[model samples]
Target chain A: RAHSNPFSDHQLEYPEKPADMDWSKLYPYYYDENTKEMTKKVTITDIGCGFGGLLIDLSPEFPNDLILGMEIRVQVTNYVEDRIIALRTNNVETKGYQNINVLRGNAMKFLPNFFEKGQLSKMFFCFPDPHFKQRKHKARIITNTLLSEYAYVLKEGGIIYTITDVEDLHIWMAKHLEEHPLFERLDETWESNDKCVQIMRHATEEGKKVERKKGDKFVACFKRLPTPEII
Target chain B: MSLIHPIQDIVSSEDGSLIFGIIKNEVVVFRVEEGKSQLVGKWVDELDRNEVIREKVEKEQARQIAENITKKRKTNDESAKTIESENKTAKIPTPGLGAPTVYSHLRNVTLSHGEKLLIICADSDKSVIIFDIDNDNKENVLQLKKRQPYPKRPNAIAISDDDKLIVIADKFGDVYTMSVDSDVKKIDGNVEPVLGHVSMLTSIVVVKDSENKKYIITADRDEHIKVTHYPQTYIVKHWLFGHNEFISSLSVPQWNKTNDLLLSAGGDRYLYLWNWGKNELLSKFNYEKLIDKYITDAHLASERFQNEENNLREYCVSKIVSLPSNRLVAFFVEATPLLIILKYSPEDNTLKLFQTMEFAFNIITMNVNNNQLLITLDNHESQNKDFIKILDFNENTDRFSTNESLSNNLDTTIASTLIEDKTSHIGSTGIYPLYTTINLKKHGESYS
Candidate 1:
């Protein structure tokens, strides 16, 4: 139903800026008295994190780093929240998987509001809405306008990861990321060795669906280029 | 079953006979007579009792259940008969308006006057509820005395010790004060900005000076604390400045043995004690010193993630309560599992960090009554497992500890030494039926 509406309102509710956002409620575990501030930034974010299989797998691997999943669907977000709460409760003694959280947010519109400039280290767009029609391309997760917002939040040497079974969406994401002056394409070796890429390729429900269908997965990786130094 | 909302604020009567807690949509009063806690009275919004809305909501839910039953019946013949019978007899209690529609942000203040207890709570929906819990009656009953709506949503509320005046702080960085008997008036052109901050005000505290002059102390997100003359809010007494981050909590503790002091803690890792009357900084306690020794059981996502960067993890001081004999107990969220006790010496103007007590769960709110420390845990998991733990302070050890013997006794719901209530029970008397079958049928007709 959401994908069929090409002209649906894109505006979303967001905080004015990162300072106005209460990060403590989102990542309570990272708050400490010594620093007197939110110590951990959400270094990695998965846009349209459907079913959150990728986040569930990646949370333990990067136990120190904060990971966030942003999903637009309300029920999907609720499911993720319950899942995380269950995981946290079951592992309270060991304090396992306390680093990941999910929020119901329109990542395409509110990316800048949630993240400070140069705040993010990695961003993922896995099996996002293809929005195949030329007129509906703007609804696709990756776009030229959204890439600039992504670049503003991503730190220098940060990575933007994209993978999809649909070649159209993969090409759309790669073209937008490559066309943006602030990003550079990463070679195949970087994609092969990166632990995150491996998980993204196999962990998500979409990845599993593609595997069941015997479809090919197109993966693209891009690095956020540092700004040029002035003389 | 009643809808379970997390306890936001906890307040105890001065005589320690009663405790009032503001849950999501209602204020629950627990009577503590002879060391037994019992749910006596509750205050909920008027909208929660609108029968027309309740009928509509219930009908809709029942219709959906019926549809699901029919669909399942068609698929599985054996299971269909049991499902149909359950649907026919099982009544879906319409907890529509009974449960808070919007997650509410509530700040509560309680006052004791003779035999009556006055509790004021400000909700994010711009409604201020004043409830009177009268103990003079046979059973303590809670009555909604006043419900006032304002243009701006109030975030913090304070009642005078004498129970004469009520002051409310709103999200727009403004404070309004009026007699408890009178209604809150709208902000007009003639009204002067007496108690206000440039940023969102986090806390408002009322304290009477040595000369009996009433004063209001307010703290804001921008780290500014202002002391103003009460009633005549335009008269600025002093601005306490020095906090580098948002001031989340402000406490004015008066000890019979020592001078009255203002304690403020927030995003800045330091807890600053001030003499609000003189607007002078008395002492600052650096929390960084206690991190290594006290915070051993920190639940962080990553072991590699350092606790502090340059020196700020954005830890906030959520609660602070003062005890007798110049002692204090502070609950710091994101800082440690241990509650820090501090001692202040007026003569030397030195603040000594005393004992740190550990709790099993992450504490959300705490209140001190006599020698009992009542604490509410952050309930992010099972709502039915909420417990209010009571810990006794020992003078000999100079430390606070819970009775391990009583913690094992968990039969009662709300009265046990460790009070546990099923907050998520929808069929409980606390819920309001916000829906009905006829209304649901009408709603279904409109949609189809």
Candidate 2:
């Protein structure tokens, strides 16, 4: 489906709080039963990661940090889940593809429910739903109110990466981040130096589709600023 | 059995001189002087569904009479008939959940702190109506002032500290702020929402920080509580993440001198206390032991879950009201007859169960007057005509006892006195969904 209502058709399960979340179920390699705790938490996230291309590509690049891809559609989430299982099964001897996983969730509504304050180091928005209608503008993934929530889960100096083929949506996403007080737009020099930005431009299934058509892919990045103290 | 409607909500003026009770679509007023009560004013919602239907019927009859008088003019009659029919079909129900239901009535009511303005949400037209309350004027106590309509029906409303800004959070997960005294903006254009949630917003309250900066604290049906900056609403604050189920109520107690302690509760068995300014869940106060018996069939989930292997039972924390000078906080569960009171321990910053009062019937709604509690009960089928109860906290005994004389006197007011009318029983689903909170529990399988 091209469009899914985030408000309805939602059967996602989340922890009461981040402390109660059982990350071992998602990343069994990191959980140690003797110590009864996971070695590390998920620090990188791919929001609306349609397919497992980005997760598969980032697994080897950042083997130490855990990466999670959150998708809302049922069939797409299932496809990503099966793809991860196959990748991990084929690389069992080397213990590869053990740091990446996919989960079904409406992240716009339940992001904070799964991640604690300042728990994430990076967030990605690659080829998200445009929701081009003026009336459906609030449904877009990037808004002033939702930016506040995204700021809550992201650590200070963390980076937010966005890429879209639709120029109008690119402008809309960039304008909202620029208007927010806690985020500053990263310049082209910083984007060129960043390795994740290079991997992101070609990893997603949507990016491949756009490349086949020889379409333009607009990219923008932002860095989260620290909260100011009250007088 | 004879049926009657119960009082759905209650509010009072700053002083204890006046009290208001909402029954169906009408707001009945009472004058509280000395220890006696007297009926003073009454205002019915103008946009009531039944009233609108009645007016349409009268208009159609008038049009028919006019057509009969002008039967010779076929062209004029045809044009007038077409216009009337068009008007009649204009209000056909929209096939969306956002559309107003048949049980359109006043849902939430409050009195502005500084100004004597009575603000209320009217569901019939998805508008907020404000009235100027003047006690000196004998002719009219509640005078009509302004009616501001929104794109969606408002679910919660909170006025800023300065009394200049009115924030309305609607059922469609959007929040809008408008000037308190401003008139008709609908003709100009639709006002965009300041911020929004993708879930049904249940309650909202405006609270200030240490430096006296105002922020809006909003909760939704998705078990989320969020705090956002006021003027720069786009600059999102951290979310208070704790509640396991839909959060139906949020209250920042006045006793918290610093104004940082926020109490929230919903379908969960525990009431959560949060230091909202710092984004910390302080503690969870369990009330299931006290309210376990109160959960009956009324607290069960919707009928769609009847065939499931296990029945899901839940209750919504309907109302939370704290006192002005004391540390006593009172709250009750929806469709339950128990009113559980808590005394905030300042030393530990925790809420301990102080006392529980069991009434003969379920409490419909309650409001704080000075330090007194004005409660209206669900008294539709019983022979007792006294539906209102007044209780005062006795400092010596550390318990709340009902005042017999005042309770009987208040019963004489219009809220308890019945006028003859033909409406369905209180048990009927026409006026209110008192127990709809249980439906907030998501029932379908994961990833459906």
Candidate 3:
């Protein structure tokens, strides 16, 4: 019997609309500092948030902004969810990261489906897959087509921070990002000094693993361009 | 002085002033004007140097600075300059450490309405990548515009008439259509499947009828040519049959403005003309005689293959195109050294052999505009020199005339090696990229 092809067979499940999603379930304290009520927004997103290392490190830094971690795999998502729960439970007095949460999501397929137009300010693609072979190059997350979708959900001047231990994947991400009309390469000063970049480089599970293994990590950051005027 | 890199694919600007070629890991643009060719774009994918080494070097620098402070050495300009140089070296990202290559097999580039040159390339990574080539700048730049990852490898792609949608046919027999512009959201926020075939789809073309109805014409390895309604793919209009072997190429000839016709060619030694909407097989031109002349000359006799029951003389049509001059151009791989052009009539649904270009190398790729046809031949004898022959289609004579002096030839050793390596390593590694695989392993780890 032939093995059934499983890569893209199943219909990816998603919320009918971004607004229909229950934001309270994910972030209990998603309230504006002045209002002290539900703010109902996710300003930051980490795609392929493996082990939630970056999310955990970033949660306290931006306590007011709601950050969402989207991981496709159930276990990885669960691990992140559990890690967040533990942190919140242990540090209840600190108001403990009620603005951050993890959800199981396939960013490549459902990025635009889950986010509204210009909903996000910062997007992170950390340690993306290095599809080494030429044919599998499309499977790499940073592509021209996907960047358009990313551009749609990101606000004007939104920042896309991409980090990878694999040099090939880093170049791939940078090349695609640079080519997109909606995005421009962030200058070196902006990239080197950004707090999120430092946290992303040192905090992610892959980043930490690469550090331990003595593997090289390459980082590239781009800012989503404001809409271009029609010629 | 011309690009030394092998040309993987080539496309001309609609105005025909510039020539774009996919060379190795980058796309090179050449301006052809005033009888001079100037290199305008050389967009190369540069791998970012590993940061671990830079961090280690910085750590060493810090240790040295601490030691200097402890030793109380005299502050000197030379030492300061040395430290500054080291910092600069650390800042400069090195290149060529990794493979620094893109496995681009089949590529199609088009100039969009916004003056952007869009190149849709079939990457070795089982995904489709769109590179936006901007020529407005003094130095042309090729940037990655969009990318769609797939489970199965994409074999062929077709852009819609409006250039808003791209339909991709994959090896797993599924076709998907995605919007070219991200601002234009899907009707329901989902990429709809346009069509599917039981076998590997080799080629696809989006055609429109007189009623302005869009249809997707797809050909597969199983000798099936299917015409399905665009967007509403549940309705398969027709399946044009009668091929003895695998269908390799499909083309929608638009010489006649009134009627919609599809030109299909396969492993068999015949080309089929079909009015897919009406489910009519208009004509089938048997090219056995034309092919036999070359076959007999090359000593590849039909009688030698009579005993072979499984592999009957396979004359695959690798590339087929419909010229605006009421002519059909096809390249038969097994036939060798011959390019056949057939006169097509929409009124009577008749096709006749108009002309044949003999002694030409086996045509690997054929691109035709109104007045010119660019043909890339498979130079098996010499792997390095892959020449793209420019043939001018004379309107008065109705014949394609080759210009030997004007043709562009480049050493495609890199492209040939990539092709050979691709075939050898097929299915050896995990088809998915590292991101998906790691996530898959994470799934397994979480489950158990």
Answer with 1 or 2, whichever has the higher lDDT.
2
Q: Which order, best to worst by TM-score? A: 2, 1, 3
Question: Which has the greatest lDDT?
Answer: 2
* Residue B308, candidate 3: C-alpha displacement in angstroms: 6.3
Give the least accurate 10-residue stretch of model 2 chain A, judged by summed lDDT. A2-11
- What DockQ, on C-alphas, does every prediction get? 0.01, 0.34, 0.02
TM-score of chain A of each: 0.92, 0.98, 0.91
Which residue segments of model 2 deviate by more than 4 Å? A1-3, A28-37, A92-95, A187-195, A229-231, B1-4, B48-101, B186-192, B307-312, B347-349, B415-431, B445-447
Candidate 3, position B426, lDDT: 23
Tell me model 1's lDDT, rounded to 2 decimals: 0.66
- TM-score, chain A only, candidate 1, equals 0.92
After superposition, the stretches of candidate 1 with alpha carbons farther than 4 Å from their true spots are A1-231, B1-6, B46-101, B113-115, B136-140, B183-193, B256-260, B292-313, B334-336, B379-386, B404-411, B415-448
Top DockQ: which candidate number?
Answer: 2
Taking all chains together, each candidate's TM-score versus the true structure is: 0.50, 0.85, 0.49
Q: Residue A14 error for model 2, in Å?
A: 1.6
Q: What residue runs in model 3 are displaced by over 4 Å at the alpha carbon?
A: A1-231, B1-8, B23-26, B43-115, B183-192, B296-313, B328-330, B380-386, B408-448
lDDT of 2 by residue, A81-168 (tens): 9999999999999999999999988999888878988899999999999987766877889987688789879999999999999999
Error of 2 at B29 (Å): 2.3
lDDT of 2 at B96: 81
CAPRI quality of model 3: incorrect
Residue-level error in angstroms, candidate 3, position A211:
58
